[model samples]
Target: SAIYLWRFGSIKSRILTVCQHFFFISFRARPLVQTFTSWKAPIIWEEMFDSILYDQGHTDKNSSVALTVFAVGRYLDAYLKTFLTSAEQHFMLGLPVTYYVFTDSPEKVPNITLASRRNINIVQVEKHTRWQDISMMRMRTISETIESEIRHKFHYVFCFDVDQEFKGRFGSEALGDSVALLHAHYYKLPKAQFTYDRNPKSKAFMETGDFYYHAAIFGGLWQNVKHLVDACYLGIIEDKLNNVEALWHDESHLNKYFWIHKPSKLLSPEYCWDQSIWDKRDILITRLVWAPKHYETLRSG
Candidate 1:
């Protein structure tokens, strides 16, 4: 009877232990979360912010925001509509927003019914034959625009790829002196697996890195954003003079920039998600999701 009771108690305890582990696993930040940088910059993530608090501050200041998007060449036709319409619906709601849309096809800019204080300025840009050139040139363009236009016009600025949809509120919580987004594909992977520009000859080469930020989305205070682009543009120009291009073009340069300067804030991968590539359980809210890619088609054009 004693042996039987002891055995039964052991089985019950083991079952309870398993159940407890399962329960905690569902809530704990699995694989560990680096929610703050070594320098004390807050990494924006779900529940780490209060939207109302952020909204109130911006509202009191009567802040206006600028969102710059490039949709040159074929990307203009395929992505501009969904991206604009979705932006009208979810992006920086209740705030004044000016879209600085750079595209080769201004005629194709969708007629979005934006809320009050929302407007678009369609800027024409030359389309590059190679997709990599198209991506790398954005920094130069953004820097120039900031010097001529955005510096005095807007209190905050954000840059985005036209090939994405805003699925949730991309509100004022993202505002900072400088903000960089964690690459959704690489955030969970070890640093060893990061695709930092490894070529010794490239300006973007990095021997070590803190985080791999996505080039598809990054921005901050207008001045800081301009500073970032100016530096990146210079690096790109230098790499060109040296007859080399970074492995991932601008994205590689972006990662290298963040490694050296470190952004004032980091947006978690939840802010820049690709549904097709990721099955991450930690993403509680997907603010923006990558639209379907026809890379071969886009490149072919």
Candidate 2:
């Protein structure tokens, strides 16, 4: 109507069309947010994918998936159960999945029932006094484990923080040579505003880069993922030797790695969302969301 009024209708009709357009905008539904990175990797958003096709492709090949999570010290009691249970319900339903749970308290690990081809392995690990060490050391631990056995068994591996729950489908649409999840908090911000470590002396320092990736979720083919974690762990160790630390610990080093070696696929902020941060009008479907921050309580637990 606006086009017709502007092209053929009288002046008064054109004026009315403009007013009507503004009135209708209040009822507008969200539009699709579909795009790709400059390096030709897709940014998977809800409106941009065919889940069934991706699922079928992997299923027919009989590919197996592996999930890794750390629930050391306080987090074992705080967030592990909810994370594991929700994952059982929504993560890669039709595929064979093995969950590698790293925890200080193996007996406390949740007894979530699994489907036909699903299993869990409890790996007891040392609990660090500082939460930061617990988070940073995961890169070293995961890389070592992958080299030891996971590389031979799993087709793909995904590492996630125990402090989140699955809210929707997180399936084979995410499969790639290398996959990175855009940080929910920084995805919308410009590169200059991204919280990359600016310290020149640190190994994780970044002068400029693409989207900042979340430390909560990262994965890919076992080999690619191993390479990523190996590189990140090396950077972390180098920083410590030089008496410096990345601003965001492992997350900072992850960002630096991605900036240099672009990921083959990218998951939108919808993959790792946080409701408390901002509006959700931008996100059409949320797959997983951050469990509320209980830093003081969880750390002390």
Candidate 3:
């Protein structure tokens, strides 16, 4: 009887020991795991940034050539700052760049320059059409403004929407001499998007075809844009003949021409990613820069 009792007690004690061991292990790891996680973020961010800088060749001439923006009333402050910041970081390094602002309200923009060099040129565009006419008249206005004011003098002209902030180098190293296009979230959708997707070479996903780059925002060489604007003019006229209004105005026409002709290369999505494009975690390590004030420096000194 005593032997039996002793054996039962031994078994019970052994079970308790195992439970205690597990509890102790988990307890000891809790703070360590937290520390490791905390330390991991900076390392990841540094590595990702290094990769981007390396890929961009870290040179001024190799960086983006120029920046062109289209803005309206009461929004020029933020847009100009974003443009100036980008020019400071990338173009001012060595690339001869210009920030051409086409707006009726150019005088309202703050005069921010990179390294005391005059970096801004504000072109006053007549606001003949209301904001509601964004689809047709606004597009023509922008095109005509570029034709008249820009004269296609810039090597690269980014017709950025006033609201966006540029995150990556908009230079030759990032995209080479070829045209660079930003892949929009709606790229896959037909009615909602304008770019092509069907691959001429692939047999898989034939129903959807191979995706072709259709459009870009915040980046593109001026040479391609001149051609694209010409094509868009022709396409828009054709659309009028058929009475089909484009989904996103001239942007759609630009996508269609680029898709058919494949005149541009696809830029890394990280370059112009908005909040909707990636989650917080993905954005945390990215050197993603933008305006409109949603994100700030996460780490404080």
Candidate 4:
């Protein structure tokens, strides 16, 4: 009887110990694992990023900024004017800005009176018949020009579509080694639903991705931007060689590059809002991107 009681007590104690270990894993360890894997949490949290990150007073005084845009034909000229004027009014107000306007006819670039310490540098390039070609061409053009003109002149550069107008402060919160904007349409969507290039033959193909980054606005440190451009340009060349083009052209290439090399900072959909497509209550529109115009009519001479 004594032996039976002792053995039973030992078994009970071991069972209790096992229960405690299981409880710790179920209650404590599981949450830690989930926290690490949560996709909603940005790699660079919003609280840690702000204008002060790039403020000259806090860091270097000689830091300069360049804004790059391709306003290829007459149709985009009107939008470019609004983009430039609004940028002058709200973009890095105190910092030195050089607008590198890539256009077929540089003379058509609006003669806007830029703010203090701001200037425009028009870069002429041959025009392509298709808008898609022009978009892809921008990657090669920017990569080439940055080597010659922009790299020596600026510390940081921002590549923006000519269709957006700054409604609020597009300040230093955006500055980083490599910055990418979450697509306004797909930021809340699941990874499976993201419109990444799915064709295995294409260089931009990705079976899974973290975010559907918008190609409309992307830039960072000069070296980082240059690296991104070079990669996209090469990806396009490889896709062409294979007789396959990514579904979204340069945008797909940009997404693939950013997926393999995560951006240092990711801007919320607020950075690229289309008022016509999204509800105001759902998104805070920091910049208003005009709705897509009919290319046939808009691009006509």
The prediction achieving the highest lDDT against the true structure is 2
Off by over 4 Å in 3: 1-64, 90-92, 116-118, 128-153, 175-178, 184-221, 237-243, 278-301
Rank by lDDT, highest first: 2, 1, 4, 3
Could you give candidate 2's per-residue lDDT for residues 1-301 as a string of tens digits? Answer: 1111111122122222443211111111223443567865667767455466567667776778889999987887878888989999899989999999998899988788889999998988888886446655798789888888798888899999999989999988777678899888887777889999999999899999988899899998888898899898888888888988889888999999999888877888888899897678778888899998768868684
Which regions of candidate 1 deviate over 4 angstroms? 1-32, 294-301
Evaluate residue 183 in candidate 4 and report its C-alpha lDDT on the 0 to 100 scale: 84
Over 36-102, each residue of candidate 3 has an lDDT whose tens digit, in order, gives 1111111011112223333334242233345566665445544556656665665434555667777
Cα lDDT tens digits, model 1, 99-183, are: 9999888998888888889999999988887645775679889988888999888977899998998999888877766789999
Q: All predictions: root-mean-square deviation over Cα?
A: 12.1, 11.5, 19.2, 13.8
TM-score of each: 0.86, 0.87, 0.58, 0.80
* Residue pairs with backbone atoms closer than 3 Å in model 4 (clashes): none
**C-alpha RMSD between model 1 and the true structure:** 12.1
Q: Looking at model 3, which ten-residue stretch has the lowest summed lDDT?
A: 1-10
